[model samples]
Target chain A: MAEEVENFEPKIVAFLCNWCSYAGADLAGIGRYQYPPNVRVIRVPCSGRVDPLYILKALQNGADGVLVSGCHPGDCHYIEGNYYARRKFAVLKNLLEALGLEEGRVQFSWVSAAEGERFSQVIREVTESVKKLGPARRMVKSFEIPKEIEKEIAEA
Target chain B: MDIQSEIQKIAARLLKNKEVAMVIGYGAGSAPNRTAPVFIDKEKDVGKLVFNRFCVNNLSLYLPRLKEKGKIAIVAKPCDVRTIVCLIQEKQIERDKVHIISFACPGLLEKDGKTLFASCAECAVTLPPVYDTLSGEAKEMERNEPFTDRVADFFSKMPAERWEMFKAEMEKCIRCYACRNACPMCYCEECFVERSLPRWIGEGSEVTDTMIFHIVRAIHTAGRCGECGACARACPMDVNLAPLAKQIREDMLNLFHHQAGVDPNAPAALETFKPDDYNDFIK
Candidate 1:
């Protein structure tokens, strides 16, 4: 018989757009959905409000996984906000992948307020995937230069 | 059409001077979208010099490396002309040794590519406001705000967020160094990044290594940048860093009231120190 493996709890960061995704997550909570408790939600007004830098920062700050959930396509309350985010994230994803980030480290999906079940399912899935991946090594911010050395650039 | 005959005539006149060795200008490529820098040696080749919407290279980056046989003539667009003005002001080159046949610029076209230069989108092409000889369309008026409001919006980003944006951009860098090579003001004999004794950048493309290269290059161009937007155009990753350039331009102009490559006599912002140079904001 194969050895029974222990289920791991992943540390996930969800950037939810305030208009729809956040409301969906809230509905999931009110409905007593058995979603994973690993996620720390940051409520932003629009998906465009979630800049790619914010994702990088979360990863640097030790997020095992990042889930950027927004309103469904053409559904952003702030007309065309998601369109900009779509362009930027597409670029950001390629850069991260080029930097050796695995496919599952960062994921984007759309979850509307009408789909509380989908939001619950996504959180649970992201948690499981990240648990398998262990942690994000590429996102660590290891570039801090010493102050005196930096200050003496002209003199040096 | 506006500049072809005029440039040919000027190149002929410049070649007559014994001290002048060459005339650097644009040549017709295979099509309308193409233009290349032509170094004119023979007077007959002067007819080859032409200017149009496609004449885009800043070309000043070449001047510092050339072991000039004698005085050279350059086809001066307003931006390249601005670069020359700064170089002359810095005594990097002798102004009299070169003849500048400045041409009125309508604007420049993007190199035939999927990725278009964003700077061309923001270009006013007017406040290259002065030149020695100009040809092409009727000159336009200088812009008052020009290229600042965008930088101001980016400035409103939280410092942490701003740093992250920069990180994301630098992360995409393949260490091509195209941005540095394309910059007209980056004409150091031995650039700080390449110094063996104290290499400012590591010799590899580790994220941190590339971050140093970009941060230093951007800072170095601080007040010297003429906002030509050449650096961002040369980037393969589409990491448009023009906001940093725009910010530096605005800050220098605001505090020092100095515009780079514009005035023949203006000193570099860092060089001529003033006891009363604004210190109120500095802690």
Candidate 2:
């Protein structure tokens, strides 16, 4: 049972902006850098397009961790998309932290297209962090109806 | 003259002169110490308009609905005026088409009448920021505490405790959307909650669904919310939804040095960005 538990791999959802972070991840692949295969990447047009709902939905739908990566400040392909995204991410992070999802379950990073090695490093770190926290039990929706509510529905 | 009578006279004059199509203000509700929104088209009905601590509805919520009805005269509190400013800034309503009659509020009492509402206690403006006409004396009130005091207190709690509190708060939601309806800023024709094709959130009273509904709503109102406390007050279950909005508002001030509804001509915080905006979290 201990070995089975130790072998558990965390499922991480990564949202990478099309301009910078996605290319960075691609470069990581081209470089053949070895990293955890736990991440599932979703390429967005820009970091600004990554709405808080997307992150929340990922967690709700059973993602063990979420990583949102974008262009560095002043380097957005859209000029200021990452700037707006920065403000939004700050607020969302605060709210999520306050709601108790552990410290590193959700993360943000700036990875340029040229920084392939950095991309792999971020993924490895995120995977390890989420692995340490184990599977997310809170905020994941359980489809089962409560016995009391089931009884009420049957009676009605 | 007392503030109540002055407001009535102003509303009456505006209606009598046909200067506006209608006047939106508060009137006595069925229960004692309750006030309902009253629309007065006739000058004589202006007497129904009253001002008191119980008049807690952010009257600005009615502006967008009445936009196409022609020129309107709205009786606005300082906080309600912020909503008007936001609506005008968003172009939901034409500034020239509506006349504002604003008042200096001392503070408002909760429905119980014994204590001041949390929003009222934290109010930074006693006088309307912009108005065509004004009433009441500007009473000096001091805010010894920070605007984000309540949110900060909640943030200081352990993650488990905060999560438990959040769950407890969201559990009472019945998906009525009264909070949305009562908000002036929530004027989206196809609210995300109602979307179907790429449905953002499921329409269910389950805890996760309800939480998603609220979390999205709160995020939608991030820098745009005027902090009128209408959403929280409108919830029949008394769920405290304002803190989420307030937390964002605090962030807007701290991160961007911006406050919603303060300057009509200024661009929204999220719509504009500085290259050097705070981003230490982005590693």
Best model per lDDT: 2
**Candidate 2 residue pairs in clash (backbone atoms < 3 Å):** none
What lDDT tens digits, residue by residue, belong to model 2 across residues A116-155? 9999999999898788887886778887889999899898
Mind giving the per-residue lDDT tens digits that candidate 2 earns over B16-111?
889999999999888877899999999989889988878878888888888888999998888889889999999999998889998787667766
Off by over 4 Å in 2: A1-7, A145-156, B141-153
Winner by TM-score: 2
lDDT agreement with native, every candidate:
0.69, 0.85
- For model 1, name the residue pairs that clash: B102-B133, B104-B135
TM-score of each: 0.59, 0.92
Task: Give the CA lDDT, 0 to 100, for residue A92 in model 1.
Answer: 52
Docking class of 1: incorrect
In candidate 1, stretches whose alpha carbon ends up further than 4 angstroms from where it belongs are A1-156, B17-19, B30-32, B112-117, B121-130, B141-156
